[model samples]
Target: MAEKGLVLLYTGNGKGKTTAALGLALRTAGHGQKIFMIQFMKGNPKYGEIQASKFIPNFTVVQKGRDTFVRKGNPEPVDLELAKEGLNLAKDILQKGEHDLVILDEINVAVDFGLLKEEDVEDLIKFKKPNTTLVLTGRYASEKLISIADMVSEVEEIKHHYKKGIPAQAGIEF
Candidate 1:
């Protein structure tokens, strides 16, 4: 474990927020470091990352939402419950300091969508171990998170293939 773990925040109205976190996870795995990714508002196991986890040693991906889309303004009761469950899992993982890298995928979006409270997440982050690198990925990151992070990257979507009638590719977008 490193002496000083970093708090990395990847956010913005863009495409690479989660991709950036996944890249770190890949690098961590390459170095034989353990990584645990808790995917919020994403339950589908068909995502490339989740499928790829089977072959990647020491990398785990867990999703905590239904397969269907979660309505932004009016999320279901299960959605709220799942988000809380994911948060609790994250807190336990952070406290244990088992993984070298811990990623809360789409956490910012979950907060922005009111699935999780910002204060709850802020409190959760306080439990991070000194040796565990923490990552938060999603759009609409709050100012408090950005201020507290050791590194923050906002992915700006200058252009997207979806706008040009191009569907998301399997490996590329998944």
Candidate 2:
């Protein structure tokens, strides 16, 4: 059994939001605890973390979007369906309490982009087991989510390599 779990949120218009969550997942896996990540609005199997999870014990990564970018305020029907499917999977993961750490990757963006409803995510958080640590990542985290979270980290982008004409490198940003 795990210690008292926390509801953590990492948000803002900066990089490392998902990186921070992955760091925590790594720590959890280091302790031989289970970790599950459901990535919303991202379906690229080539991502470094998705590739690395294959070698990590008791760690699972599920992607729920296509390789194409989702247009804000006009997401496709398949995007909506995939997001809903991911949310339902998250709910089941929380209820079952099978994983010590659960990461809802890019869920805030999904909600902000109208792919998923805020209330539904809120209720999912409420339904989470006491022993399961929940981590929500992505920008534009709602006030309600912040209020409910035990800890919230906003990663403000002071500077970025992307603005410096540097493209995303493999294993660094994926």
Taking all chains together, each candidate's TM-score versus the true structure is: 0.97, 0.97
Which portions of model 2 show Cα errors greater than 4 Å? none
How does model 1 score by TM-score? 0.97
Could you say which candidate leads in TM-score? 2
Model 2, residue 26: C-alpha shift (Å) = 0.5
Inter-residue clash pairs, candidate 2: none
TM-score of candidate 2 versus the correct structure, residues matched by position: 0.97
For model 1 the local lDDT of residue 174 reads 87
Across 1-174, the per-residue lDDT of candidate 1 in tens digits comes to 437888999998889888899999999999999999999999989999999999999999999988888899799999999999999999999999999999999999999999999998899789998889999999999999999999999999899989999998989888
* Cα distance off (Å), candidate 2, residue 170: 0.8
Worst 10 residues of 1 by lDDT: 1-10
Candidate 1 global lDDT: 0.94
| CA-only RMSD, every prediction | 1.3, 1.2
